[model samples]
Target: MKVFVYGTLMQNHRANFLLSRQKYIGPGEIYGFSLYKVSNWYPGVVPREGDRVKGEIYELIHEAEKTLTRLDDYEGEGSLYQRILTKAVDQKGEEHEVFVYVYNGTVDEEKYIPYEQQPWRG
Candidate 1:
């Protein structure tokens, strides 16, 4: 399965720790979506013109579904983020539809900044 991740799962960011344990095929980006800060972490959503959410796309092993769902749970899928199908780009420059976690309406737009500008934790 193809998964799109912005925020901490990009390269060596904090959340990448979790992704590292899984079988990731490559890196990529997802357009038409934007990222935001939720508490100390970040989540993404469908975008407007001025918004750009940058991240990597990973192809998971078929057996990794359970692990991926657990990640969704951790991200608060039902509340903070809703899993949605969107277009994402891969390190090979291929575009495809993948599942991504997006922020729900509960998030205040004024609070989030670009994930690249944030400090990371060990």
Candidate 2:
């Protein structure tokens, strides 16, 4: 399956080891989501109407389960983040159903990350 990554897991950053071996499809935009600064090193996303988030898409292969499990723990799934199936439009205008990590908590109005800025660049 494809995964949408907008923060440390996108291109170059820490905690991206899990995606190092995966096939990078391309850049994409996931609609109905908003990005926010979670910390200095990472950003979190949440579902929101009329919003969009930019990120890269990767196809998970080779021990997908293990990688996903590790990512779950790292992302604090069920607490800080939750894995969800969402649709994203790739650079080629192709829509893909991808798994994305979304913030589980409430988004503060002060923490909104605009599209013009890198999500993790706090």
Candidate 3:
């Protein structure tokens, strides 16, 4: 299984331990969505026309199901964030269907982070 990750799960950020054993598929981008700083430590992505969120893709080669379950817990699936299958385009412009965790609750107006500036900076 392949998973798309932004925010902390990206290359050098924290929470990467969850993917330490996974195969790095390279940088990728998901279109028609915008990323916002939901908090000081993480960002949330929501659907928006004409927008794109940059991230990386990984292939879970071993214990794929267990890895996904752990990711669900880390993401607070069904509450804080919801994991969904979506298309992510790689640096080479090739698209692959991957799972991404999206914000599930209401977003505070004051916390809105524009796409021009990367919101993953902690």
Q: Give the alpha-carbon lDDT of every model.
A: 0.67, 0.85, 0.88
lDDT of 3 by residue, 1-122 (tens): 89999888887888989999999999888988888878778899988899888889999998999999999999999999999999999989999999999998777767766666753666
RMSD for all candidates, in order, please. Answer: 3.3, 1.4, 1.4
Off by over 4 Å in 1: 106-109, 112-122
Worst 10 residues of 2 by lDDT: 113-122
- Separately for all candidates shown, the number of backbone clashes (residues 3 or more apart, or on different chains) is 2, 0, 0
Residue 89 C-alpha lDDT in model 2:
93
TM-score of 2: 0.92
| lDDT tens digits, residue span 39-73, model 1 | 65455554555555666677666457886887787
Q: What lDDT does model 1 reach?
A: 0.67
**Could you say which candidate leads in lDDT?**
3
TM-score of each: 0.74, 0.92, 0.92
